[model samples]
Target chain A: MLERVRIVLVNTSLPANIGAAARAMKTMGLAQMVLVAPKIFPSPEADTLSSGATDILAQARVVSSLDEAIAGCRLVIGTSARSRHIPWPLLNPRAAAAQAWAELPVGEVALVFGREDRGLTNDELHKCHYHVHIPTNPDFSSLNLAAAVQVLAYEMRMRSLEDDQVEAPFWGVDWDIDAAPAEDIERLFVHLEQVLVKVDFLDPENPRQLMTRLRRLFLRSRLDTVELNVLRGFLTAIEKSSKQ
Target chain B: MLERVRIVLVNTSLPANIGAAARAMKTMGLAQMVLVAPKIFPSPEADTLSSGATDILAQARVVSSLDEAIAGCRLVIGTSARSRHIPWPLLNPRAAAAQAWAELPVGEVALVFGREDRGLTNDELHKCHYHVHIPTNPDFSSLNLAAAVQVLAYEMRMRSLEDDQVEAPFWGVDWDIDAAPAEDIERLFVHLEQVLVKVDFLDPENPRQLMTRLRRLFLRSRLDTVELNVLRGFLTAIEKSSKQ
Candidate 1:
């Protein structure tokens, strides 16, 4: 699966970034490198930055245009740090990799990275089937090109590992299971919020920040279906008692 | 919860990384910063690297030892890129943050990062209740300390955001609902291990890494009480069958 994915650096200016990209990709078990009109390649700076991953550079395909690089690819994803006004089915790196992995065809899958100064042009991005934005700090979203490649490659590798066969625990009368469903958990949160409001623990007028905090606390729990039900039942009992 | 978490850097050599760490923590809504035996402080380098997060550095606590920094912390999580013997209850960053947020008492929660070169000594790590190993590329796991801090801070902040009340989908439920105690899960692991040993799945004479792998797999699942009970029952049944 990693072999099928090619990292395409389009119009990259820095040879060091190109080398770093190779090193990052190689670190994450990705070897295919496509350099599209880089300012300098086969330079000492690139080789030095690549660390021990010179093999990736040696085998890299240097193309003239993004179209030529992704010509044979079945799945195309453009890496962008910023969101676009023209939404093109944006997926986070993890989801995008999952989607690409699930829908991979016979041809190569291209991950296009743009030049350092500016990201991919709208026209070039439009050629992609999906856009993947790595969640970064909103204020300073200047992720190095190599870092971006590293994140995508890492996510793809993790998704691939998850695809390997792992037996799910058996579910039946034989095993006594007591876990809540997702809906019940969602309901519990609603009930809890009301209780907080009733007790004045949650200020109704200035409630945005408090409520957001509460949501985060529960989401971190990643409460399974059964756990949700149990929590909801507890909340229901509490609400009933408070009515008295 | 974010208030309780103190990001501690021990024997930090670079002032720039310290500044970067401050920026990362601030972005993630984590305010507490502790510098343990740093080579330098209030350096212009740190100020420059901190960007707009100089306030975090202004309020930073300087300590002499890892122990003093985390004296009041009920839950101490140490970060390392490498694996160690007697693994201190390993967790990924998200899971560790969740656990720390849920379990920590009304005191400091230390997240100790080690020196740039050697990392935390085993003795220093022993003080932690759990070790958080960020899954980086195994071949080149040399992540900048500040970068590592950024990843952790981001996860903690993201989780904290979800806990906010107003935006929570399940805001009505009381978050104080009883959770199956952590001790119960720990005991269950012991019981399950005993059963595995009895069933020859875990061999005492020539243990070939089976138990370690099993422990890692189960620990990764982050099994709650209900899931633990289900596994325990299965193990009990296997034991009864063997006796018969």
Candidate 2:
């Protein structure tokens, strides 16, 4: 079950921290690791820090972009530093782990971590279905990279260790049907943006925050594969009507 | 309430580990630290590793022994590696934090950690009224000293941040009364041991596990001050009856 969950590091700075993150993940029985444009990889520093868990580093997949990292993942949860601006479905680490576990049976799930210095960009954050914030001392919220991973990974491990109690269905009765993967969601957003611009509801000259808000609303609902197709068809009908 | 909680490290070998532990504690809103017979202190290495949490390292109280470190604490919880031989009331980190929170209002509480390499000594482990074990991958359970501190401290902080929903009382309706402090509990044990030896119930030549089992039973109950007095009186009565 844990094998299907991937830890995605986006633009991580220090190689040692990457190794440390791998070690943290391994300690919690998580093996899958995906590095998105890491500053350096396969470095001796990372190897040294990973200690005996070098197998995680050896097996870690390196990707050129976050898109490639979370490509087929149906549920992508980004780690965000507490920010009031990103009014998305924000969850604490424990709740996030529960959500991840709930989705794990459906398809691949990704727990995405940001750069060591600045966390996920607003654009990158928008790509995620949910954001998880590790609540820390407000005065000293500078959580070390691996520490954040450790906390989240620990929560994930805890969730896995729990008895096979029924997890509250994330999407009610329709949960058995797979949720649309990231790429499908991305295409939907792009098509929706184009239709909005054509209909003159959204200004092409000044997009403003309308698309972002729309994305949040849709992401929060987590469109299933069938729902995605229906939405796509609806958008195609709108285009046909506009052409007529 | 968090202010009343102290993190005690016994016989820590590295100054850097101490510093990292301080950082972890500070991140989780814990301020007090007690170091028992550390190999090094007031070192730049500790300060460097502490990052911006130097204030915690600066204010940390260095004591000569574990007894001195936990001196007046009402509750002492030791972090232990899973050992089947140590048959005592062991709690996972989350449960330990809840227990700590339940006791925090009564008096000071201590969370004790042993050396980085060997963890708490059997003698040191006996000093704690309760033990907390963080579950890890059994194959690679080499949790870093600071990481262990981070997990426990994080749990403590989470407990503190929770709404003041009444904690499940550790001692029923008598919860309003003060629980016996560590020193008082220690005294009760001493008196009981003496009386047991006098009655030949406990062989003084080889005490074996009798005292340990008794400690576990009494510690699990968490005697209130009044109960402590009652137990002490009962022990005295036993001694008098034995002498007659």
Best by TM-score: 2
Candidate 2, lDDT over the whole model: 0.78
Model 2 chain A, poorest ten-residue lDDT window? A164-173
DockQ, 0 to 1 scale, candidate 1? 0.03
> Scored by Cα lDDT, where does model 1 land?
0.69
What lDDT score goes with residue B67 in model 2?
Answer: 72
Model 1: per-residue Cα lDDT over A183-241, one tens digit each? 34345667888888777688888875565555445543445456666777777777777
Model 2 chain B: ten consecutive residues of lowest lDDT: B165-174
Off by over 4 Å in 1: A13-16, A42-51, A104-107, A163-244, B1-5, B19-32, B40-61, B101-108, B157-244
Model 2: runs farther than 4 Å from truth? Answer: A164-244, B164-244
lDDT of 2 at B187: 68
Model 2 residue B89 CA deviation in Å: 0.7
* Candidate 1 TM-score over all chains jointly: 0.58
**Fnat of each prediction?**
0.03, 0.19
User: What TM-score would each prediction reach against the true structure?
Assistant: 0.58, 0.66
